[model samples]
Target: MKAVMIREFGDPRGLAVVDLPVPVPAPGEALITTEAVGVAGADVLIRSGALAAYGFREGHIPGGEIAGTVTAVGDGVDPAWVGQRVWAFTGTGGGYAEQAVAPIGEVLSLPAGLSAVDAVTLGSSGVVAHFGLAHAHFSPGETVLVRGAAGSIGIMAVQLAISGGASAVAVTTSSTERGRRLRSLGATHVLDRSGAGGPDDPTGYDVIIDVVAGPDMPAFLDRLNPNGRLVAVGAVGGQPPADFGTRLMAAFQKSMSFATFSAATVTAAAQQAVRTEQFAAVDRGELHTVVHEVLPLEQAVVAHQKMDGGEVFGRIVLLNSPFH
Candidate 1:
């Protein structure tokens, strides 16, 4: 099996393709013949060493999610899973290879019409978005905002917000073309990445799915409707400072709540259900996955470079072979 390894941190060029023995599944796990691997922002952060505090060591593989077919299952697993097409979380590492191992619980079968590429892109991101919104306590006809709205998670958040009956969906992004693309994705208003935020209307917003949090987050706090909640799901912009709460104190009167969501903590059954719902929605034409491009697995370095360049509109995935 071939995998991309990070020989060093701080540079995408440090990612190198290397060969290794294929891994066998342990108890309660399955071995997947890699078909598509998701290249995500967190994977880039892992490669850059920014997330070193997360317990991962050097020389670790960088992919987090993969979609493929089960070739074998370990003890206590159902043999029927063998030959079933599925999408899985490869835990803290191991998804960048031609073959990867995952716990059976993390693997979900793909529906008839969902291709591996679409499944990996939608399955990985959709589950995260669904979990965030589920816990954020959003309601019908309310206003919502999604930061970094042109990215994979952002796109899903926007469409899901609309479908959930939000009266309006606002987005934040740096590119004009990408903002236009986001609008087409159902964002009612698109705000510049650095701006006063969508006017201080009292209607405000009931929920916010923020993936990009930084110094300007306090501004969004004022944009939230009273009793509204802001769910911090990603820090692509940068992590909030240690005095984050002090900066946003002015919004305390609104009884606003700031919560951080990590899909890792969600139950496997819940995550699998979300993935299945998203695939079904895509099949029914009620949802869509924006794929920026499909690159070969060996081009992981180039993919990281593009992610850092900051113009990508949606998910950029890697594949081990050409498949339908």
Candidate 2:
């Protein structure tokens, strides 16, 4: 099998394609013949060795979400899963290959009429957005502000907020054109990435789904209304200052809250359920999957480079079959 691995870390150039023996499904796992895989911001972090403290090793295969057909199933798994088109979570790695293995519990049957590209694009990111909102205790009539709302998860958060009946869906994007694009996805207000204007200015938001947490994060705490909940789902912008907690203390009177969320923290069943629901929504035309571009599996390095360049507005998918 041909797989992309981080031959070294810190540069997109470190991602190299090499031949490897195909991985076999362990008990309760399924081996999928890859059709497509999603490249995410976390892949960039892993490639750069930023997640080493979390057990990510050098030379690791770096992909999380994949869409493919199951070719085989392990012990205790139902034979029915074999030969089914599905989307799956490959956990931290093993997805950047022609074949990948995932726990049976992590595999989801693709909704009818959903393409592999769209399946991988929305599979994991949609689950994160759904769980992030649930963590923040978002209410239907409340206002929502998706910080750095241009990535895959951020895009999903915007639409989920609207569908959940948010009185207003606000987003902080990098430019007017990107903001306009988000508006087309049902964003009611598009603010600059500076986190100003709209619900963040005077009125404040009832819930804020932030994907970018950096030095600017402390400032967004002030944008939360009383009793507001700010759930940090990703920190592509790097960590906030150690003293950032002081911001929450300063807002003590307002009872504002702040916490970080990861889909890993949620139960597998819960995550799978959300993925199923979101995929069905997409199949039904009630949700959307925004794919920035599609590249072949061999061009994994290019995909990582584009993600590092910061111009990617949505998910970038890699097809196992080369493009002619």
Candidate 3:
């Protein structure tokens, strides 16, 4: 099988397409013939070795989310799953290949009318968005602010917040077109992070979903309502403030709380349940997976390049196209 492996940690250039033995499913697992894989910033960070502190190793396959079909089921796995189309979270690696292995219990059967491409885009981001909204205990009629609104996870967060009956306000860079796109995804308002029209008055929002952390932290903390909850899914801008004192003080003063989500923090069962709900939402026409582009698996390098260049609007998927 051909897989995208980070031979050395550096840039997207380090991601090499190489031949590797197809993995067989172990007990409680199933082998999936990969059809599509979602490319995101996490893949770039892993390739650059920035996430080494998180246990990501060099020479590891770099994909984390995938959509594929079950070809075989291993011992202790239900035989009925064979030949079923499913989407799964491949925690660390194994997604950027012709075939990947996932625990049967971790796979979610694609809901009616959902395609592999769309399902793959839901991946970890959608699940995290769901969890963030759930953790916030968002309710109808309340407004939630989503930082990095144009990002993959941010976009999903916007939609999830809306689906949960809350209004979404998104903060993004000076990209009017992207702001419009986010509004279409359920964001009630869009603020330009690069310009004067910034996030509105602090303490106005019921929940703050911060996907980018940096100098904005102080202002974001100020904008939270009393008892507001902030969920940080990623630090697209940079690391969190070195002085946790100021941020913690602000949170305490406002009676606010913060939470973080990572693959390690999510269990297999939870992933499956989230995928099922996401797929159902897609099927019910309540949520849509916005795919910006799709490239052939062999052109995995191009996918990484697009993501690194920040040219991708939504999800950039890798399909098994012969053109690659």
Candidate 4:
């Protein structure tokens, strides 16, 4: 089998393609013949050594979600899964290869009409958005603000907020073109990323789904309406200032709250259910899946470059050849 590994950190060019023995599924796991791998911000973070504190290291295979066909299953797994098209979560690694193994519980059958590329794009991101919204205790008719609303997770947050009956879906994006695309996806207000929030309407957003958290994150706290909730799901911009919480404290009278969310907090069963629901929604046309481009597995370095360049509007999927 062929795999992409990090020869060094801090540069996308550090990603190198090499050959390796195919891995066999362990107990309660299944081996997937890789078809499509989602190139995500986490992959970029890992390759750039930004996630070193989280245990990512050189020689790591940086992929989390993949869509493919099941070629084999381990003990305690259903044989019927073999030959079935599915999407699997590879935890935080092992997906930058021609083949990967995932626990049977993390594998899901592809919904009818959902392509491998689309599945991988929407799989883990959709689950995170779904659960992140829930973590904020989002309610129908409440206004929502999705910060950094350009990537797959941010895009999913915008659309899901609208479908969940948000009174208005506002987003913070980097460019006019990106903002335009988000508006077409049902965003009611498009604000500049630096602006941090919408116009000063005393009644601000009832919920804020933030992906970018840095020194600027404190600015959004004031944008939340009284009793509003802000959930930080990603920190691509790095951690906020140590005193960032002072804003929430200063606004204590408003009863506003701030917290962070990770899909790991949710159980595997819940995550799988949300992924399944999201896939079905995309297949049924109630949801949208955005894929920027598809590259061959060997071009893993190129994929990381696109991610680090910060211009990709959505996921860049890596495709694997069946012959490999």
Candidate 5:
């Protein structure tokens, strides 16, 4: 089997595709012949050594979410799963290959009418958005705001927020075209991502799902209604707000609450549920996965480069070379 491995940290240039022994499924796992895998912001961070504090090691394979066909089942697993087409999380790594292993319990069959490419595109970001919205508890007939709306997770968050029943879905994005895209996806308002154009309503927002939390924390906090919740899902912005503590103290009077969410903490089974729901939504045409591009598996380095350059919108999918 062939896999793309990080030769060293700090740049996408170090990524190399090489032949390696196929991974064997352990107990409760399934060996999958890969179809497609997601290229994500987290993958960019992993290649640059930015997530080393999270304990990422050098030489690790670079994909986490994949859509594949089960070729073999491990100990204690039902043979019925051996021939099913499934989507899964390979966990921390090992998905950027011709073959990978995923726990059988975590592997989900592709919902009818959902393609491997589409499912792979929605894989991580869609699940994160789903789990993040679960934390936001967005309700119908209420206003909701999605920060960094042009991002993969942010894009899905916008659609899910609408489907979850928010009467008005406001989003923050840097470009006019992207804003138009979000509006077409059901965003009622498109605001500049710099945290500008706020304090629009004193009643504030019923829910705020923020991914680019950092210096913009106070601004988003101000947008929340009394008892409103702000779910901080990511920090592509780098710096934490300098006055976060003081801002929190001042913002405390509104009775709003703040929580940070990482899909990393969510259980596999729980995430699988989100995956199933989102896939069904896509299949039903009630939701959409905005994929930017689909590259061949050999171009893993190019996928990482585009992500690093902030040149990608929605998600980039890598088609496993096996079928091609």
Candidate 6:
């Protein structure tokens, strides 16, 4: 089996394609023939050694999200899943291979009419969007302000918020063209961060989903309604200012809640359920996964570079060229 392994974390170029023995399913696990894998920001962080303090094991594969067909099932796993197409959230990393073993609980059958590419694109991003909206306890007629609206997770958040009966205000750094794309994805209003008004004046929102943290946090907190919630998913712009105390005090005084999410803490069952729901929405034409580009597995380096360069507007999938 061909796999992209990070023998030493340093840069995207450090990911090396090497031949390795195909992974076999362990107890309660299933071996999947990798079809499509989604590249995420965490993967890039892991590769660049920025997350080295977190103690990720060396010689590990880097992908966290994958969709493929099951080829084998391990002891305690039902053989019925063996030929089923499934999507999985491999939290620690192992999806960037021809064949990867995933715990049965982490895998979900692909809902009718969802393609492998789309399924992979949804990955953790879709699940996180669902969780964030649920955490905010949004209701019909409520309003949501989503930062990084043109990105994968942002787009998913926009669609999910709208589906949950909330109005979505998406903020993006992309051009007017991309803002139109976000609007088509269910954003009631698309605000360009690079434009005149900026992200600060997000008036009338009951909830704010800030995927791009840093200075935007204070701006978003200012826009939140009393008793509203702010869900922080990513910090694209380095770290927040050291004097974030003022904003924290404001949130407290306003009775607003601040929360964060990561796939590591999200249970497998929850992810599977969200995946199922998202797929159903896609089938019904109520939800869509925006895939910006697809590259062959061997071109994984290019995909990583694109993501790191902030050039990708949505999910970038790596296809298992050898298996295809």
Q: Which stretches of candidate 6 lie over 4 Å from their true place?
A: 194-204, 250-252
Q: List TM-score per model, in order.
A: 0.95, 0.97, 0.92, 0.96, 0.93, 0.92
Clashing pairs in 6: none
Give lDDT tens digits, candidate 5, residues 77-167: 9999987899988878899999999877778999868999988888788888888888877777878888878878998988888877888
Residue pairs clashing in model 1 are none
Local accuracy of candidate 6 as per-residue lDDT tens digits, 1-324:
999988777767888898899887889999999899998877887887777788876687999789999999999999999999999876678889988988889899997688889998886788888887777787877878887776788889888888788754556556778877887777767666732344554565788787887765676667678888888888775566777657858567678777776656777777777788778878788788899999998888888888888768889999999633
lDDT of each: 0.86, 0.91, 0.78, 0.90, 0.83, 0.80
Give the 10-residue window scoring lowest on summed lDDT in candidate 5: 194-203
Give the candidate order by descending TM-score: 2, 4, 1, 5, 6, 3
Give each prediction's root-mean-square deviation over alpha carbons: 2.2, 1.6, 2.3, 1.7, 2.2, 2.4
Give the clash count for each candidate: 0, 0, 2, 0, 0, 0
The TM-score leader among the candidates is 2
Q: How many steric clashes does model 2 contain?
A: 0
Q: Is candidate 3 or candidate 6 better by lDDT?
A: 6
Q: Where is model 5 more than 4 Å wrong at Cα?
A: 198-203, 322-324
Which residue segments of model 3 deviate by more than 4 Å? Answer: 194-203, 250-252
- Which pairs, if any, clash in model 5? none
lDDT accuracy of residue 298 in candidate 6: 83
In the range 204-310, model 4's lDDT, one tens digit per residue, is 78999999898899999988999999999999888899999899998889999998999999999988888888888898999998889999988888888888887
lDDT per residue as tens, model 3, 159-258: 8787777854645545889878887777777776732354453336778888777666656766668877777778766676777447757467677777
What is the overall TM-score of model 3 with all chains considered together?
Answer: 0.92
lDDT of 1 by residue, 2-116 (tens): 8899988988999998888999999999999999998898898899899889876678998879999999999999999999999999888899999999999999988888888
